[model samples]
Target: MSKHQKIVIIGGGTAGIMTAASLSKQKLKIDILLIEPSENHYYQPAWTLVGAGTYDFEKTVRPMENVIPDGVNWLKDSVVGFEPENNCIVTKFSGKVDYDFLVVAPGLVYDFSLVPGLGEAIDKGVVCSNYTDPIHTWKVIQEFKGGTALFTQPTTPIKCGGAPQKIMYLAENHFRNKRISDKSKIVFATPGGVIFGVKPIAETLMKVNERKDINLRFGHQLVKIDAKNQIAWYALAPNMTEVNPKELEISTNEGLVGIHYDMLHTAPPSVAPKFIQDSPLANQEKWLDVNLHTLQHTRYQNIFGLGDAAGIPTAKTGAAIRKQVPVVVNNISEMITSNTIGDKVYNGYSSCPLVTDYGKMVLAEFDYQNNFTPDPKLKQMLIFDSSKEHWRLWMLKKYGLPYLYWNKMLKGIDV
Candidate 1:
């Protein structure tokens, strides 16, 4: 006999756990099975702070068993394939598992191999990434003695678009505190033409760059790293076609340029997980093909998706998952009770807390259209301008948000 569940949730990350918790609290008496292989769950937003030596690395993780919602079955198995046509999933250990409804939230994968020599360079002298090991990142930053420090952003979509720069700002603060700012050359090399996608945030960041005396290299994508020689290679990305006088673009057609650095911090290129990419649920871009608003699968009515792997046009941050969890849960509830998808829709809301310095941050919140969409509740809570860097926002990032996440968000209480 095949194991079966009324509702099957894939991946126990933020999206899946939150969804399961929300459903468990509801009066709906459907049996829920969550398929996840990992033994521990991570609060990834804190990794940036951890890398900057602002937070403890251990605080960002917890036993997976501790967070799995009560009354839900936890299947410690990996999903290798999806049989959406028959409402079944193929797992590596459990074999075939049938479901009445399915939720896909396997998250995304970081492709360090995309950059030649990068895989071997991580956590090895002078080269580190917050995405991989925040502890080693802090170690590298602490041990730096002031030379050409290079921070890079990959061309591929990452979890937090602003993360690459957040660590840089912290390192700048660290270098300044150590009286090495004058001797160090801080460079931020990114593939994007603008410092930030949102114009207001970008303008604010430009001012920060000026204040920090950081060298901004736009239209540059990291391709390779010579770890032993401490050299980084970049390919010139195409210029922005949109004619905005306020925006600037590099007009160089130079095929490649190599820069020598004493220290390097980079986020590896991110892509959809291989299983999701190989599945039929994936779109042309290989992301989970879901209705952006409803979070429901386009082809399969019984399936829904959220989080980084979903094809939502917004920054893939934990704040995005916060808004998405409610939408997906409500829609699934409607489908179960009324046999119709709910009208509750996701607005593609995403937030990136850009840590500018030791105790200041610019809370960049936006929607699908890239409009500055700050949380009204957060505005009232902090009582400060989120567009500008403020210590209150930093406190929110450092203290308040973590409490809210562990206590509220994971428990499925919509904050």
Candidate 2:
């Protein structure tokens, strides 16, 4: 390694750009290089509102050139392969670039094809996922007149677990607005037993479910979809045992384990990209293997990771990235100064603003330990306060959050 460090950041999404901004502000004597294939950088959380017809898709994205910090070098190319042994990454257009330190933030890949007939259903207007770009979500909702409108969550972890429910709430509200609430049937099918991960929110969601007349299909896994027949099938596991209230052992056999749906809003199985999957930096489970506390590579010391790519067992949301970026930036700085990743530790802090409806959200915050915590004392707390259904949070999601993301979070402005 040279006297001055050379840092390479792949994927200029939320994590990549924010880390760059944060590191640049520290004024480290280092050369920062960022590689990204996409010309457009998206505030992905905003896509949920876009799918609900509350915001425009065009407004959800900004040019990548604008978001990249002023001092860093931006490589407009995809990383085809990683040569972690050489401390370098091979780009598609540009050849190999070596680095003293590497930061991989390539977001998780959504596998829509994992569930049979999902591709066909998406095309045939029977399926829609907010996670995808060029989203036709509102069209899918508009096509639904009656019958069962199913929302599904896969066994695999997703970026925003709450997002599946967010869309469901919107669809339920849509049916109510159209005076079709009684006529339309809404159901939630999940591999998990509960609606929300946090208990307080889950308890509240149960009440919301009853009021909305939504059926809860627990221990149900989506296996196939028949777009032609407008039928979606899920594997049934009745009398399944689960730890309820986050700890108490309980079993429920009454809920429908296997249920069919007329129109399905599916959240596809997601994972780290194939390039990272093939690299040594990947965990035994095939995720980018990084220290849960430091966000530094477990096996490779020079390589660090954050965002959805990291193997940290937490909810992979932008809220999580907001917490992880600082830990990663600080630790990387320590590594540069001491020729090793110092003792800076991440508390495994991650957050998810569980948007129950257009106006209601339960801000679920917790550390990596999975211990239940409704609140944590961070400099900038993303609060999902007691106001489950309020115009204020809706306005925040609609107007304030994006402004904060672009101007503050992405720009490295303190919250």
Best model per TM-score: 1
Model 2 Cα shift for residue 215 (angstroms): 0.3
The parts of candidate 1 lying over 4 Å away from their true place are: 1-5, 240-254
- Give a tens-digit lDDT track for model 2, residues 88-108: 888888899999889999998
Residue-pair clashes per prediction, in order, are 0, 1
Note the Cα lDDT for every prediction shown: 0.89, 0.77
True-structure lDDT of candidate 1 = 0.89
Instruction: Show the colliding residue pairs in model 2.
Output: 360-388
Best by lDDT: 1
> In model 2, which runs have C-alpha deviations exceeding 4 angstroms?
133-135, 238-258, 372-388
Alpha carbon lDDT at 281, candidate 1: 96
Q: Residues 1-415, candidate 1: write the lDDT tens digits.
A: 4333399999999999999999888778589999999999999899999999989999999999999988889999999998988889999998999999999999999888889899899888989999989999999999999888889978888989999999999999999999998778888888888899998899999999888988888887788888887888888767722221222222222567777888999998899988899999999999999998999999999999999999878999889999999898899888877889998998889999999999999999999999998778866765566889898888999999999999999998988
Q: What is the lDDT for 270 in model 1?
A: 91
